[model samples]
Target: MIKVGDKMPAGTFTQITKDGPQKISAEDFFKGRKVVLFSVPGAFTPTCDAKHLPGFVEKAGDIKAKGVDVIACIAVNDAFVMKAWGKAQNTDGKVEMLADGNADYTKALGLDMDATGFGMGVRGQRFSLVVDNGVVKQVNVEQKGEFKVSSADHVLTQL
Candidate 1:
């Protein structure tokens, strides 16, 4: 998996905007900025909905106060699903909902988890990374079925 000191890979994540779907490149989003990039296996899943995403949304202001330029949530779902989940979570402009629809970014990061047993196919492992100017500064990847790390609070502490 990609670790601290590694540069973020080149990839595109879709974002559903008012004008429709938009493509955002990793370079454009993370280059020259401090970013907190967190990934969930799927959007609107139990743990993700109840804890992961909400934690980031709630702590976004404090995180940004630490000099973070962007707080983003990525999932292996489509832009439409990401948009809907963002709306449901009331994330709106607080967190950028990035859709890694085909698991491109997740695979590129080497964080892809085989969730076939759960009938979810390929998904991203629960993880969070602090990236400064596209280079990873810190990373917290959770063990399977665990949520001990890769949390907003933990990431905040790291920051």
Candidate 2:
């Protein structure tokens, strides 16, 4: 598993937001800015919907105040689902919701989990990374079904 101080892998993915489809690349998103990216197993899941994503949404402003350029949420779902989930969370313009539909980025980062028994093929483990200039400054990966270190408050403290 990747850890704190590791450089972020180069990757790209497309996402659909309230505006439209947008293609995002690692360089464009995190190369020169401070980014706090959180990945979840899936969108609309209980913990993701109720806690993970919402926590980011609630602290997006405070995070920016601390010099974060972007607060992004990534999940192993399609753009439509990501978009809808963002809307449902009332995070239409606040958080940038990205879809890793094929788990390309997730696998590259060595963060993919096999949840076949539960019907999810390959999903991203719940994790958060602080990226500065394309390098990972810190990483917080949650243990299975736990959401402590990856919470927004926890990352804020690190900041």
Candidate 3:
């Protein structure tokens, strides 16, 4: 798993735009920026929809006030689904919803979780990281079926 002082792994993420889905490389996104990147098992999942994404949206201002440049939420879903989830959560101008439909970025970070038993197939684990200019500052990965350290409130304290 990625740890403090390590540069983010090379990968690409899909994000929705006015024109269409745009591909953003990890290096490009993390370079010269302080970012709070959070991941979920899937978009529109019960806990995620109810708490995870909402907490970030609520605290985006507070988080950005602490010198963070970007706040992003990623999930193992298509770009359309992620975009819709962000819209439903009212995250406009706050959280950037990222799509990791192929699980490439999750596996690269060693944060992949198997959810085949739940009929969800491969998915990213619930986690969050603070990255500054492409280097990791903090990483919080939740335990199985648990939500604790990876929360927006928790990350705020760390910031």
Clashing pairs in 3: none
Clashes of 1: 0
lDDT of 2 by residue, 1-159 (tens): 667777777888788745887888877888789999999999988899889999999998888888898888998999989988988998865788889999999999898999898998899999999888888988899999899999999999988
**Which candidate should be chosen as best, given lDDT against the real structure?**
3
Residue 35 of model 1 has an lDDT of 94
Query: Which window of 10 residues has the lowest lDDT sum in candidate 3?
Result: 143-152
TM-score attained by model 2: 0.94
Models 1 onward score TM values of 0.98, 0.94, 0.98
RMSD in order of candidates: 0.7, 1.5, 0.6
Computed on alpha carbons, the lDDT of every model, listed in order, comes to 0.94, 0.88, 0.95
By TM-score, the candidates rank as 3, 1, 2
Q: Which ten residues in a row have the lowest lDDT in candidate 1?
A: 143-152
